[model samples]
Target: MPILGLKAPGPSTPAHFSLEPLIRPNILALQPYRCARDDYSAGVLLDANENAIGPALPSASAKKVKVNGHSDSNGTSGASASAEDIALETLSLLPPGTDLNRYPSPTHDELKRRIAHLRGVPDENWVFLGVGSDEVIDMLFRVLCVPGKDRVLTTPPTYGMYKVTANVNDVGVLEVPLIAEGGKFQLDEDAMDEAFTANPDLKIVFICSPGNPTGTVIPLPAIRRVLENPKFKGVVLVDEAYIDFAPSNSSAAQLINEYANVCVTQTLSKSFGLAAIRLGYLLAPPPLIQILTNTKAPYNISVPTASIAASAVSDAGMAVMAEAVSTLNANRDYLLETLPTIPSIGDILGGNDANFVLVQVLDGPKGKVCNNRAVQVYKTMAETRGVVVRYRGGEIGCEGCLRITVGTRTECEEVIKQLKDLLA
Candidate 1:
């Protein structure tokens, strides 16, 4: 079958894969609901029937909330600085003429352009904005999978949300566990191929790079092998939520320009430090992007979220993110080195390519990993102690493990301090 031949589709140009067939017919033929700000944003006086009186927030502080994303004296994004101030008084201002009384731009072209530049994609045409990667994931299932008929493939010990979303959509999820016994949390290409061959009807495969709970990146060559497979014709969704912490070459986004079957979802919630705004996007071929756009809600993103996200992905914003990633990577290294010094610590899993680390808590001060003690440590740290780290001991290949986020120097010290006292 030349459908998804095992060779590169063609080195000259992107594969001419027809996305219409991949998308649900209803979505492909969808007549998107035109939003208020779709046509004219300049002279929109009275079109969408918005409240003429403007927002209820004190206009004095509200208008002053304009989050100028331009660079600060420190050469970092001003918006990044402002966002870090969690105090309620730091109300963000809207973009010029971005009236709170009116709806936000449906396309968010400026935001898409920033994302395109950041991802090194051709242009905004290659981007699809979503409430978060969760929205993108849910929509992928909605537009690609048929309820109770079609299914998606996922690697175990990855993100849990993929399965939860699958269940919510009533779609079957085929689990192919990563090479856990190897202690690397890497993709098992052979098992994955077998699963794809067996489940020929699968429509989507979720590859969580810099995998959640694992903190390791799946190699791009492995991803290419999956994409080029003649048997699996489904779309490959690469979740790169933590790609900022990894080397640039590790991103699956580099494959989007070449592979029609590949899509990458990213977010400002992580390295960009905009989790409160809850923004994420997908980078894919224009056809797939159009399909997602058509199927998405007309006004999915709000005024404030778009403003903040646009700034976060801006040139200045990216610089800030780079510096932040560097700091976190250093902290991750510190954790990897220090966690072992604690008594009863076993091997630390994953590549340490993310802002977090997964460490195995031992039975006593040094032998084999003990899941029970790890659970106890997790609870005590959260309740008894003033710190909170995720308990991933129950996850596959992560038995007796705790997932710790690399926090500020003081916060990390507190975690290490608590672990030492508790385990001692």
Candidate 2:
């Protein structure tokens, strides 16, 4: 029987596959990032221009002392560092095995194993480890979106990276603002449906639960609605970076096996307390994993990052972190209940589920009051009371709002004290 006319043998037949058409034509023609050599054999290496005989980058110990205020040599601080300070400190440390002059592992296998075991996801389903969750978000746009031709949908007052990545990739962003009625924000299904209808070619839908800025979790039923829509054939990226902070468990990892179109991205930066390690993960179907791997830069994760991240995911580490998260949640609750008592604060976004809460400042007679006032308050609190919070406004709908990450119990009490003084 001719193969064209006959039904192929099921499972037993020899499989033949070609990736020529599946890859984007543009991506196939693009040149990837070229760094150091891939091989580590005993030989003089000088291909990539580097100071072969120079002093190495600053040690982690040195960097830690400069950045972290604590007396510990490991750079771990008793108090929280500002995000910018943390980023600067992390950049000071060189990649692992720098003195050995050998190339690190191309795939970060050990890290993957630890992550897989910790997350309960099979190793095969993850791909494209990057410096942060932002990198993965960028990669998702690069792999799935056609830029200008395709679009992605996100609810505003969410993580700004989804929009920023879309803009950087030259992809169109279709935003549907979440409903902030009755002093609580939730996913607006009607707006989502309308946006999807308007943009049929949307290749990705970015949903951050216990959403950024808003700190609202998209309801499970609402998520199911989006996934079940036949019109949504493209990938649905659910960013669970802050999910560990939420009261409820994450839906992204749990729904992965059920929905082929769903892909969940997470980060160690948030809950794992390994923000300096620059590790994030994606949980998707094997096919999507293959596509992401094919498109991602080779050796995207460095050895030190992989090593520390894997260590951070241990059972004991997770237990300690869980306690920390609980403490933060309690702190968040304290702030939520207490902030409203002071005047000038309007509707709050996110409720019990988030690690942070969004406080909307009511504008006075001055034309569209400045939200930076909250930042000013934050700065004063940081300097006087040693408490720091994020100011997130200046977006379309986030006017006069401040994003406050929950701190330790004592730190939170200090914050409350400072805010009370400011309000008074």
Give the number of the best model, judged by TM-score: 1
| Model 2: how far residue 103 lies from native, Å | 1.8
What local lDDT score does residue 299 receive in model 1, on the 0 to 100 scale?
A: 85
- Candidate 2 matches the true fold with a TM-score of 0.76
Error of 1 at 189 (Å): 1.1
lDDT of 2 at 264: 80
lDDT tens string, model 2, 159-196? 87787888888988887877866535677788777776
TM-score of each: 0.90, 0.76
How high is the CA lDDT of each candidate model? 0.81, 0.66
Q: On residues 286-329, what C-alpha lDDT tens digit does candidate 1 reach at each position?
A: 76776777788888998888987877777788889888888888
Model 2, CA-based lDDT = 0.66
